[model samples]
Structures are given as C-alpha cells and as structure tokens.
Target: MELLRTKNLTKVYQQGKHTVNALTDCNIRIEQGEFVAIMGPSGSGKSTLLHLLGALDKPTDGNVWFDGKDMYSLPAEELARIRRQEIGQVFQDFQLIPIMSAYENIITPVLLDKQKPEKEYVEALAERLQIKDRLHHFPAELSGGQKQRVAIARALLMQPKLILADEPTGNLDKESAEEVLNLFIQAVKEAGSTLIMITHDAAIAERAGRVLRIDNGRVTG
Candidate 1:
C-alpha cells in the first residue's frame, strides 16, 4: 500500500566550485490514503523533496517510485502524462490563469487532455470547498482565501491518486489558513486520497498523520 517510495534520493546543484546538495541519501514511504507533511526551514530541501514527489523535477541520484513504477525512469512524455493524471499540485502562489474563471481554471486539465469534465464529481468538490457560488468569478475578483479554495477544488476535481501542496496556506491570515488546511484534511479523509504537503508552520504540520523534517536533504529527528 505504498503510494509513494523514494530511496537514496539526492539532488545536487552545482554553482561554480561550491556544490550545493539539496537532498542526500533520503528514503521515505507514504502509504495510501495517508496525509503526510514535510517541514523544514529555508534551504532545507523541503520544496525540493516535494518537487521530486510530484515529479516536477528530476532527481540527481536514486529513484522515486509511484505504485511499482519508477517515476523518473519513464520517458519525458510518459512522465508528463502521469503528472497530469495521477498527481495534483497546489502551489503557494495560486497559479490560476488570470483570464479564466474559477470553473474554467479548475477544469483546464480535462480540457487539455481532450476529456470531458465529470460534472457531478466536480460540482460536489466545489460545494465542499465552498466555492460553488464563486465559480464564475475570475481570480482577480476573489479574495486570497477564496482563490486558494478554488485552487484546492481544482486539485481535487481530478480525483487524483496523490495531491502535493507546497506551502498552500502560507499567504493567508490565520483564519483563512485554518480554513484551507481543514479543507485539505476533509478532502483526504472523505475521498481516501493521499496527500504530501510542505509547510514551515509547525501548527499546520501537526494536523498531518505523519510529519517528517528535512534538513540538509536528510530526514532529521
């Protein structure tokens, strides 16, 4: 039931003579339907690890496997397809298309893949996220919290195998932040989906089933 597994995963960035090792010899397993959080200070490879998990970037060494298939072993086109179908990402910046409404932004994946949106499931997700009424509104017309809710709804609309959130609530106020995190918890619990989140907030990290800290690319005590 390991939805995600990584072994001896490492990432090194060569900047002139000094080589920066973002991650090193790290191994972690996340079970299905689990909500896990990764926490660390800046430059601790928190984002790097999340990126690797989401297949956004390639690892310098070792392997990342989803189910039984090696993620990095796939061809670039296959990896892209897997990223779209199996993994969903919620970024801190709320990367919504400025011209698109909430509804359009959320279903862009389906449209791009030449598949029709599953209307019933998508509506349920929007209602759960409390963004049903705001579907027609552009990102510019929504509050910071509302935008994030829309982002969350979009991520869930696909019913993806795993969702990776990077500092999802970092830009919101306390109440808004709590609302977003609660929505994430509810989604994973209710839908039986897996989540891997990166956050610097200890309070938020405490809500996860498992919390692993990364420092100098290694899981720390």
Candidate 2:
C-alpha cells in the first residue's frame, strides 16, 4: 500500500531579490512498511523535501497525500492534529527539553495532545531501545548514544504511521551509532511502521531498504 506520495512537488524560496528553487518537479512514493533513505549535499533540498513530506511546510506547487488524503488541503488545525498523531520526527540535534527527563521527553507529544501516556507500552519501548534505566535522567546527563536512543523511543511511542529521521546518527560515535541504528530499524519493523531517513553517509544509507538520491532539487535515483 502507498503510505505517502508527492506529485510534482515543488518548493521555491525567495531571498531578498533572488528566487531559489529548493525543490522542482519532484515525485516520489513510499510504501506502507518500507524503509527509505534520502541522500544529498547541503543545498540539495533534502531537508526541504522532508519538511514538505512531513507537512511542516507547504509546497509551492504540488500535492502530498498521506494515506490517500491530501495533506496540504486540510485545515491548519486538522493538519496539526494529523502531524501530531500520525507522523513522528527525529532530528540530528536531540530536540529534548532540557528540564524534562527521558521518560518525560518521550511522552511529551502525548502530553501535548492532552492524552495520557500508556505506561506499559512506553516502558516496553524504552526497554527495547535499551534506555529504560536512563529514563529518569536528563538529556544533559546521558551520552550521545543514550540521548538518541531516548529520541527514538519518543518517536516510536505513538506508533506513528511514518517516522521521519533526519541524520539520527550524525552525532554519535561509530559503535553507538551502529547500536542505535540497529535498535531503531528493528523497533520500526516490529511496529510495522514506515521510516524515511536523510543521511550524507552512504554506509548509513545502505541500511535503508531503498534509497532516493536528491540532487539540484530533483531525485536522481
């Protein structure tokens, strides 16, 4: 089943007097349980595509359909609801609250939505991510790997339809990166969720089932 798709997706940015095409005539689709990796250089619009795919930003001209529903056509509130409930995002810089503990951080989204966090499920997920013991610790206390693991746990807490990870392992050391990557992949598969990741490392990208190479605002592979 097609979980997410973009048709003729385009993004243009105007800087002062210059018009820049961040993404142009791009088209892509992701299957329901597939893992996809997006690779590109710094200015290749990789992040722009992710922002659009996740509905964080609007496309200049195109349509983004998630589960056959047009994302951009929805009202702002409805779109925000879907983004909160159906989509999960992980970033290179762990976006955790400085004052919140690991467990608190993991359940932040649920709390924001005015819902109660499922304790059992959250505990199990933390165990799976191997950060159960550190749940009480703050982000500043945990190592890079530990922090990323907590981020992964948070992303998977809601069992979102799609998990968007941007340079998830970019800050970790080799061993930690490998460990987190393995846990992340396994957890996503076990949850039967789709994953789309952006990385500049080919070796890391290889872990994905399919890779889409973006260059000059277009998919080259």
lDDT, residue 51, candidate 1? 89
- The reply for model 2, stretches above 4 Å from the true place, is none
For every candidate, C-alpha RMSD to the true structure in Å: 1.1, 0.7
| Steric clashes per prediction | 0, 0
Q: Score every model by TM-score.
A: 0.96, 0.98
In candidate 1 the C-alpha lDDT for residue 78 amounts to 87
lDDT of 1 by residue, 57-154 (tens): 88999899998789999898988888888788899989999999999999988787778998777778888888889999999999989999888887
Candidate 1, residue 85: Cα displacement in angstroms equals: 0.5
The residue-by-residue lDDT of candidate 2 on 1-221, one tens digit each, is 99999999999999999999999999899999999999998999999999999999999999999999999999999999989988999999989899999999999989988999999999999999999999999999999999999999888888899999999999998899999999999999999999999998899888889999999999999
